[model samples]
Target: MYFTFRQVQYFVLTAELGTISGAATAARISQSAITESIRQLEEQVGSALFSRHARGIALTYEGHRFLRHAKLIISTVKDAEDAFTAKNDNVAGNLRLGVTNLVAGYFLSDILARFRRVFPEVSVEVVEDHRRYIEHLLISGELQLALMVISNIEEQFALSVDPLMRSRFRVWVSPKNDLADKSRVKSSDLRDQKLILLANEDLLESISGWLQGEELIDQVFLRTTSVEAVRSLVGTNTGVAIMPDLAFRPYTLEGDRLEARPVEGLSVTLDVGLVWRQGSPDTDQAEIFKTVARDYHSKR
Candidate 1:
């Protein structure tokens, strides 16, 4: 039986979100449309795709069987679209990019500057968010590409990741603060001090693990999701924050209101990189952007 792409998309969205309403919102369609589409699809298959429960829906056995193939079909369609779009030399197309704050602070401007110079007609849009959210966007086709801290990516199975540059973490505080005299503060030294950090779950978990190893888990004071918030909090001398050095340089040097010192044995540095769906089209503009990013970082 022939299955349409829309049917698979509706089916997958419903399955993933576990409710027709949720799926409709995600797919940007009305609930009745998704309901009818799924009904038609189930009729074609002659088996129950989902079992409706009080809370939501669960995939039936037949649904599980079809989902794997459905994902492949969607991926193939996306690859075809990317390939066709990548054919243009002028790069006169929309490029949706997702980036974390650090990438936005350090790498984005240079990349955008170079890309704009090369492809003035190309429209570029950027969404700044944490790593997890960006990855979600990449998988959902909401973002064409993303730049993030690479230490968070555990596997490269379905992604093409290109190493852009390496950066390390450091403990930041107002230079006038008492800790500035030390070359590097130890984990134990931080125990009595109020610690601030970008409220990333993975980063928090990583720090928690390190603190636990050092038996200093109870010392954190402020945890925020915004890096700018961390900076503002730290700038006000509310607490000391640990952040990637790349992001703190400008503020540390120019803001005279704050300072950052190396934290010895903290092991918080990160390798920043770019990621896109594996097997996506590689166009000349994309290649040029990579080259420009590498060259720009190399000089710094």
Candidate 2:
């Protein structure tokens, strides 16, 4: 079965938005266009990708399987384009950047890799620290740019934020846990459950706000600074966790499966992107890096 790149893009978008209309709106095309694209894609694959419902649609088992392949195809195509585009630009210089611990691990690596490929002569120095410290580095002119979670940035008036992506918080559980079967786990559902919290200051503050009340706070089992530790502990059913979907993985390092489900009353999302001093003149290297990072995320 043959399908164009556009078809795969449409399928992935529709799967993510969970509705043809929403995908069409996001893609800036008509709903009929999205429907036809999905219909042709389903014909090509010889299976229904989504199940229609009153509110919207849900991915079928086949759709879930196909979504993974679709995302890989998109990422592969974007990488190729990035590599080709980078070869055309020869701008190079030292770029001093700052990053928080969470953003460094989850988001910065891919952007840095693409940037280096494009500007091989550029020396990239990264300082990893807490979000507040990263912001301080940016403000003090010690860093040219910072990639961090911008949702809780304190000195917003002093910095310019260029947002790349926003990821929602979700409840993560082991497949053996009862919450794994839930379509949406409410905050109240976690009141009595043992909870594993990540030790990032920003995440801790947000979670603390959401999980208010003595009963919920008292349910905290342990707090750690390692993302992998949270994954492993949750995978072994030691405790479930609520974290940003951006850092989520289906399986632990030890090969145990984990599941993420939507939180019913959670409307907060983690915004990650680039931040720079408001009036600082952009150097050639800093400008190029920012462009590359923004383009990379926009494609994704």
Candidate 3:
């Protein structure tokens, strides 16, 4: 009942990393400090949040239930802080934005929601397209700003990019799959496994580049652009998927659980960010949105 935000933050990180040492390393604190925070949080909640094992810890049922509330608490605190500091009550303008399909589904909504809340008077028009077409629109000045996967931008030199977040790729497996119990999965481990690949060109290209020479091409069982389809297939034990953590969900729409495991040899990350034409004059709307996005990602 008296736990601090720091405790909740530590709790969340510990839950995410599944190890006190990993959370400590991420938080730049001592392992004992991370342990204490989790202990205090568990005490405050009056339940055991994690089941400890030789490898690491896993969330107890109570912990999984509490994780949702903990994340909401952090989000609510961030929104409240942003609301208090916002100075754009009188700002009003129309803004044109472009987004890739993957980004539009995962990252755009939260940022757009925050932007709208901060600048309620501003009208926003969003265009969702493939990354190439979005880049064309950005270069043509048809779009003032774009939220996209900036990792493989074809026009990198022609655009100015502000990376918001980097999400590393992980192998998604059904809870019942043999790979789900593994701490880390190697590309070789997936060579014979059925794969459910996302059909987005950018994602496919990135995945292909990393997974090259792994003999996975012939193992790909299905290719679809739908993230949910991939989730469902992976959750139902149809196949495993290697995807960025940004788009990961623990459960499918049908409530089948999925697990994400780090890839041993995969070092690629999906970088999503704001992009604009390099030489174009930054409009007031663009600058304002950038500031909000910067602030939003900074807190995360």
TM of each candidate vs. truth:
0.61, 0.74, 0.79
lDDT of 3 at 174: 91
Query: All candidates' lDDT scores?
Result: 0.73, 0.87, 0.87
Off by over 4 Å in 1: 1-89, 136-142, 250-255
Question: Number of the top candidate by TM-score?
Answer: 3
Error of 1 at 259 (Å): 2.4
Alpha carbon lDDT of residue 10, candidate 1? 92
Q: Which ten residues in a row have the lowest lDDT in candidate 3?
A: 209-218
| Alpha carbon lDDT at 211, candidate 2 | 72
Model 3 Cα lDDT, one tens digit per residue, 164-183? 99999999999889898899
- After TM-score superposition, what is the CA distance of residue 162 in candidate 1 from its true location, in Å? 1.2
Q: Candidate 2, overall lDDT?
A: 0.87
Error of 2 at 295 (Å): 1.6
Tens digit of lDDT per residue, candidate 1, span 1-300? 866889998998888788999999998889999999999999988999888889888877577767757765665565455445554465576778888766777668755765565556678788998777788788777777787777777546867798877666778886656787788887677876788867675456446666678776566776787777787777767788877766663242224355678777888556788888777777554565666566556644
Looking at model 2, residue 35 earns an lDDT score of 96
Q: Which ten residues in a row have the lowest lDDT in candidate 2?
A: 82-91
Mind sharing the TM-score for model 3? Answer: 0.79
